[model samples]
Target: MRAEVHAYVADAARLNRQPVLVLDPLTALDCSEAGYAEWFTEVTEGIEAHRALVVLKDKECEAESPRTTMMTVGVRNLRAAAPGAMVFLDATQLARKQDPPGVARTLATWSVKETAGVAINVGEHTPQAVADRYGIELRQTLAVTTGRRDLYVVADSSRGGVASADGCNPSDARIGSYEVLSDNPETTQHLWLTTPGISDGPCGSAPASKPGQFVPELATGLLAGTP
Candidate 1:
């Protein structure tokens, strides 16, 4: 289903004249666990094109936990690519040691400071818990398709979320402010996006050699628009 959907979307995007978002699988993998400064810098610099879609593989560890190359690296890269580009974070990519609730809060905090749109795909066991941590509600948005049940959620500081800290929480630092798309920043704005298969499948990055290839349902959910 994931592969089928991506192939269809990629093909559709091509025919419809949509911007092609690309990602470097190897780079994402390299930055997965610990911060690989060199790799992160190199990869972020490579995807500098405006409006380019960036995708990252959500690697799952042996124990079925999500693995993040480096939370900051991914967010940082998104900021660099397009300050307004939505950052679709696959919770499964986070390591086991990293608590989902904590990570979610950290992400919410980053959203407040960077002004970037962030939508996290959560699993059953941790969904509500994360929602509470960041004070975000999983509300339903207009149905994109009958086959999928898509919902929307907002991530802002009014919900007790804060931006990633420097000096103190260096690993989760934000480089600069991200431009706000919609919703008021003064309060928790119910931002828009879809979350169909939030806990749908095993998370992992696409093959390093072909990052552009379809990655199925793992973290395929779009930020604000299709393809």
Candidate 2:
């Protein structure tokens, strides 16, 4: 699995695209120190080679848990190994389930000061509310459709303006695409583009039309203060 992940990262980098990698420490809680160190070395080497961003999730810092100690060691190793690669800490689960709202705010604040940014899963919260509470700017809005169900992806700008929208389509709708609505910092306004898919299959897709046809129009409209 780690090799496959590294291959994907290398491929994405070769294409000049940014790839997001999510790492969950809970999955390897029982691995030996030496084994985990090997994994970390591989991950750091991949990051250095691909310039990929990694999000470390589900890291526990509880006082009495052995996992907490491992988590601390893992983070230190990652920072030491890949000091230049972008890495973000995600403690949304801890914030939502175990800690108070203040905990999330503190985490967000610290992340902004320490790493690239933080990842927050606002499961049942409004984007505006989360942005206000965390004092972060709302960066992008993504609409994901799968069959008859729809999901929205919202995140703060402090985490960088990057996100992924994916879902399985088992219904007649059969359409799978992603629309990104983002704020153009230079214009102080929002701009959006929709990249439609040609098929529902994961790899069976291409841009619905030539980018030259719509890209210019969208840019012109947004620059002229037209959404």
Candidate 3:
């Protein structure tokens, strides 16, 4: 399983090495004007092909601040130049506790215009739900949980399912089918009976297999557990 995860991450890295543009709206206010100018030049110079531009698009900024104007101009320019680049405009900075409604709206708009993904950073943020409201692709992050001994599939909350959809997504998913796609074969327990889409099987009462010990039939059955 460890080997499999490493290989998967490696493949994903290789596939996404294309030139990218990152628009940051979070750091343009604090630093000195000269410091920002120099810092932007220094950072952008190193990654000319991988562009990173900072904008001061905070909703709270004065309408007259040069940084505010620059942010608007920069976003307009970026929209024209790299229309398809991955774009992220932080809205948290603009709202109460960084939960600005306008920021969420901005994220949804940019996500659609750029046809890209957005990350709503922490801070009681429910921005992803707002993204869903806009019909934007909103996939929640899934993390691997490891016991003192080893890594395993604890839960996947992306779907808001009863137990959350974990184990794997089905291959060749139909346009709107509710089938469990592919079972991730690497989780430590890999218990099929407890999974969301498979039927109960003999493994229902089977003890979780330890690290380095695999029982394919029991695992397969466990993963087949249905919602």
Candidate 4:
């Protein structure tokens, strides 16, 4: 049923020249726990506040729990089938541990580089952290879709349900304010901020996203989700 519905949508989008959004996948379905673990090797650690989307609760040792590369591949397939459709893939924010650790505890990055024509995600705090940590912008990261890598920093200082921190569900300002996530001087605002965002191409140094552009990173996702 899911496949049929997705196919129907893809066909409709292609025929009508409409845009289609796809959420990342969220299931390892056929694979066992161990198999899933192999695919998901990195996750957030030591941080008191975190999001289940980044590191699954109780399943951190394993992958995000119930995930497979096929999920990402499906997005590619959808894009191929719907050439005319504007496919956007929104994935969760993920980071890996660095041996030396830098400005932040965890690296601000995203996974699944290829698939959607554009990628949009509510990165709790990652949107700002990515800029502060790497000294780069979010749109340039691997987080955005492989095609037009554009990231939008529309809001900040909010809690979960829509997009919130994991551990304590801190606001975007708090989570991305410093390295350890306790508190830092980098934060300028404690309230939500909005931006118009770009849609033409990836923002930052490179206009087009290459395979090895940003730190590679996905988990079970919506493939097509609602805001």
Best candidate, lDDT: 2
Give the alpha carbon lDDT tens digit for every residue of 1-227 in model 4.
34443454456545763221222233434344444333222111111122111212111224443333333334334334433332322323322222212211222222233322122123333445343333223334433223343322211322112332332212222222211221222222222221112111242323453322331111111111423
Q: What digit string (tens of lDDT, one per residue) describes model 2 on residues 1-227? A: 55777787788878987666766655553455555566677677766545755666655533344543444445666677776555655545544554334444444333323344444541112233343333232111111111111111223222112222322111111111122333332111111112222222332122343422333322232123213
Q: Model 3 Cα displacement at 42 (Å)?
A: 2.0
Give the per-residue lDDT digits (tens) of candidate 3, residues 1-227.
22432343345456773332233433454344443444344333443333322222333433334444444443444454434333334332333343333444544333323322222321111223332332121221111111111111111112222221221222211111122213331321101112222222222233343322444543343334344
**Which of the numbered candidates is closest to the native, going by highest TM-score?**
2
| Structural similarity to truth (TM-score) of each candidate | 0.34, 0.48, 0.31, 0.31
Candidate 1 global Cα RMSD: 15.3
TM-score of 1: 0.34
Per-residue C-alpha lDDT of model 1 across residues 1-227, encoded as one tens digit per residue: 22432454456456763233323334433433343445555554543332333333344333322344344455665687545344444332332345534544544433323323333322222222343344232222111211123223333211112232221112221121121334432222322122222222222322222323333332332111222
How many clashes does each candidate structure show, in the order listed? Answer: 18, 0, 16, 18
- What's the CA RMSD of model 4 in angstroms? 17.2
